[model samples]
Target: MGSAVSSAAFSTRPGLLDGLDPEQLAAASAPRGPVCVLAGAGTGKTRTITHRIAHLIQSGHVAAGQVLAVTFTARAAGEMRARLRGLGVDGAQALTFHAAARRQLRYFWPRVVGDRLWDLLEGKLRLVAQAANRAGVATEAEVLRDLASEIEWAKATLVSPDDYPAVAARTQRDTPAPAAQVAEVYRNYEKIKNSAQVLDFDDLLLHTTAVLEEHGDVATEFRDRYRCFVVDEYQDVTPLQQRLLNAWLGGRDDLTVVGDANQTIYSFGGASPRPLLEFTRRFPEATVVRLERDYRSTPQVVSLANKVIGAARGRPAGSRLQLIGQRPDGPEPRFAEYDDEPAEAVAVAGRIRQLLDAGVPASQIAVLYRVNAQSEAYEQALSELDIPYLVRGGERFFARKEVRQAISALRVATSRPSGADVVEQVRTALAGVGLTEQPPPGGAAKERWDALLSLVELAEELAATVQDADLARYVAELEQRAAAQHPPTVEGVTLASLHAAKGLEWDAVFLVGLAEGTVPIQHADGDDSAIEEERRLFYVGVTRAREHLSLTWALSRNAGGRRHRRRSRFLYGLIPEDHPAARVARAQGKTFGGATARCRVCGGGLTATLEVKLGRCARCPSNVDEELLERLKSWRSDRSRELKVPPFVVFTDATLVAIAEQRPADDGALVSISGIGATKLERFGAEVLAVVRAAGRG
Candidate 1:
């Protein structure tokens, strides 16, 4: 293990160190030379990495400043840093690859591009995009974004443009981009970046590696300064990131990396674990550690997660991922099916309410979905129920108008000696918030800028007014932190689409919109690797459940009552046939009533249904025509959309069917139906009453 032992063996610390697991201890003790830690979900992969960093620092094996820890996301880096600080070691560098690349770029920009190059070249790429669009090239912003992402993926994987076709062909298995075009753009983009001395997100790493590899003194200085490197999510490293890591090592080859190949889900984004997998091959002297015991899930849930991954391709079998249950006999992962989506939403809201009543905190629950569009139903349901929930990603905070305006003000006021990272932050925030449309004038916009900059001015004045240096310091630190992570205004529950939910966890997770196309995802089925990635997504959703996991899907979406959705295929073979949901499916049969089923009033059978109910049969006549039936239902549902509307106000299928069947000619008769309460009768009583009377008269 190279003499870096567990905290328990050291007998130096008290709280956190005393409770270290053996796997964690082993991870801490292993001497670094391209180390790879393959662990299952909740097996304390994060714990092992954090402790190892702590051990390195506490043992004086590396200076805090010499240690560089790279994570896949800014949030993950922040979390790792917080954990390290809690262990009383604070000097180590913790940042995302992007952040690290930006830092290094700033350090070497003067030499790379001479003086004053960054400012003039700012947003030139946007101009390029505009020109490309104007020139009648493929220019839809969305298409450009996709192409830009394609370029980034190639760069990140360290795949030169020439290699893009073969690699993309193999990895994508379908929809491969033309190799020649990729090469041309790759060449053009590089030329532009070099000439302008500016870098896009990927160029940060690409150029930094170039500068370091070309300059021995610069490389050596960085390598010697950072003797220890700790990497989290090692499975996600692209070739470019690996090259950057090699440059950081500067041939020293001393480092600690923690990752799990099974949890590798970013392959589509051009991230690969081959570098970590081939770590020993490259160094010929490296250690590998496996952490399989999960510390977060129950035996049953862990078993489910393990079984799903076990069925996946390319993953090793023996080291199956397992979960360690924290509570005694938590609820089993339940599956439910509904005739339509609104019912599913109501059911999910009902489940959350039940959990809350049983003692789960609102913050403890998270509702995850395959995409942001799927969140609409859950948000609607939650709003109706008055439940508090936060979406994980998307432009919630960054998209707010007030917040954007406020940040523009702050950026201008705090624009003192701002480094590249700070400048990028301000630029991104300003541009994202739509302030760029009427941006403050460079020199002429000073007064207008200060006018909008009142928030920052007030905060500074407040800091000056406070007598407690500690309080003032705290305020200043908070201002800096806010300036870094949050924009001016922050409100509403997080609304993260699934792509944005990576590297994050919540207490109670509701994975809504778990339908076939959305989950395996419509686009994922074309490739085997992509399918495996989808399985990993399910794994991510499952592992995210610290206590409760609820999975749901809708039979229909849209206001027109279009019903053409199927349950997620990923859940097909894994969940047992005897499960409650399977039995429900068996009962419903393969084909069921969908949206636009013929009105019982008109006596037409648009779609056939098995005899599962009493009121409507294949032979019955609908009270009103199809359009009238649909209109009545639409009116009823619209009322349901209003906050605080009682359940009965929204006519249940049974009640609607009864009204259609009986053709009630008056309010007295309509009020007699099930679920038609006094409140509903008073508010919508006349509407229903008139519909019935009109139907009878016609």
Candidate 2:
């Protein structure tokens, strides 16, 4: 672990090294040799590397055209080019690995293979679907995503289809399908691509490497053309990527790699931190510099980030770069707990409202969660609060293809009365589109499944609260939702997953849904390595907060549901075990809820959606069915529309919620409810009683 380096350590210099700290200046102007930069999160890695490129150009060490810099994403590549241009240096090749490789392959294919280069595949889902069919596999749209990921992994790891099964089995890879079936799919995918004369993203790198490796003259020309190389996010280098990097170097050592081993959370995508960790071993005389001073987050946030990553197991000794915050201290991170998922979302949105009210620009704040599926509740909650929010790098809730299809199916279902439970009816409709209880293997398919399953949860909530909930009304709500999440003229708070939130920062970050199964995730249960990666991902989330940070989770998924969820184990050492936010000490089974939840009406355990939302239960002397209240509200809304009156004219929302909690079985008890008088009861008594009876509440 590196110690804190104060500003006293930085030495002033002229030209490109003007504002660079001592470590950065050393790394930037290091002798012409292999350079390794262990750039911790929030450290000025981009600044150091980009300045180094400019330094090399102005100092006559390397020509601008010969400098090839590659990063993982196009946005980062574009930023690199823009920064280089800002420094008054032009003609440098700053591009994504695929972009750089595609250009090289396109230029060399005719010379090397004596034929035209095939069309490059921007996405492999279409081809994977075809391959799935050829393999006698009936793949859904989501399964195609899983297959594509598996195929990409195999190709990146340089494992042939014949070797994929053994490699996958050896690594205990959680393949989308059986090892043999996936291998067959991969084999057929290659065959189909070959017959169609096309190359994918991975094939570009592979082909470029092959051209250089086979043709000595071409390799010499390429190496001479591009004399200096700088690779960002070196910890994410897959085996195939590293091989191509080596071919680009052509046995020379004019290479610089910037990465942090602790931030290596993309292992599932075949990325290995080995290249970054063993950089010195590859080039014995490499100049290694560790940039531990973080300039983004405050000391309080930095300390939390350090603790999170430090708690991970199997991290290489001395390889974990301990971050030292360079910024002034702000407020300490806040930890919050809620009763359920919806409660969590509402609370987060309310906190954001407070921040916005206090004059923090919405664009400066963010709400990040473990997965994209968790985005829907936040979207709905924000919309309810009239708080603008944009789902960054994810599909908006109602805009998803599955959601649109499910809504269309539900619309068709309203043609006749099914008389079935709304939740069950939703299940039937979703199943018509191949969405069932069990989700497919991880990746796009699993994410799609999660997105669709969230709809079922909404239906369950609808049925729990609304006695007269039907397919038509549910479809109406979804349509309203589709229209509600519109783009605002003003910049909105960002909602993104942890993976997407990487490389970004926010002033106030609300990290929600940190429950046991969500942050560590259920799939990482048995694997220590997977769990460690989760820890790293959590660390990433923690570091994204520049000042105000709130880490929150819920006791249950829904109101009144069993509060059995344990806080994420990653927080065990970070937060106090006996704190109110952490309700239990899992190892000791000790309880820590500040206030025990008890039903007000019957003093019984409150553990279901309606029960918690109502704060009461059935079997009380005066009762109103929570389910019946929802039914009354739905009926009241439709009735009010017919009568050309407001919904409150039929029955207030509070009255309906109270009715559900009271579980009133008779007209006498119904009239006793605050919102129901003798006159009002006379008008709607028969219809309300019929709904309650249908709900088995009367």
TM-score for each prediction?
0.71, 0.71
Report per-prediction Cα RMSD to one decimal: 10.5, 14.9
Worst 10 residues of 2 by lDDT: 584-593
Please write out the lDDT profile of model 2 over residues 1-698, one tens digit for every residue: 22323334433336657888888887887766788888999999999999989888888888999999999976577567657866777789988889899889888888988899899887889989999998887789888999999999999999999998899889988888899999999999999999999999899989898899999988988988999999999989999999999999878899989998888889998899998877777777777888999999999999999999887777795367899999998988888877789767766876897899889888789999988989877876664444556677645656667667877888887786787878888888888876867876432355467667767876765566455778776776556445434211225689899988877788999999998999898999898888888888899899889999999999899754788997898888787566577332233321113444456766766443333344554444545565676677888889989865456546655557766666667899777554355546666777877777787834
Candidate 2's TM-score: 0.71
Per-residue lDDT tens digits for candidate 1, residues 1-698, read 12233434444333545566776666665654556666667777777788877876776667788788888876677667657766666678888887787787787777766764253243434644643444344656765565566766777778886777787677642332355555555566666667665657777787788888998877876776778887888878887888888877777777777776767778877787676666666766566666777667666666667767767887643234454444456667777766666666656776776777777766566677777777766665665444545556543444445545755454453544433333343444444433354544332133234323433333443335443323233334335444335322222233456666666665567777778788888888777778988988888787776666667776666432666888887777766688666222322232221423333444343321222221344466444355556656876777667633443325555466667766667677766553354555665678777766665566
Q: What is the lDDT of residue 124 in candidate 1?
A: 38
Model 1, residue 415: what's the lDDT? Answer: 43
Residue 496 in candidate 2, Cα distance off native in Å? 1.3
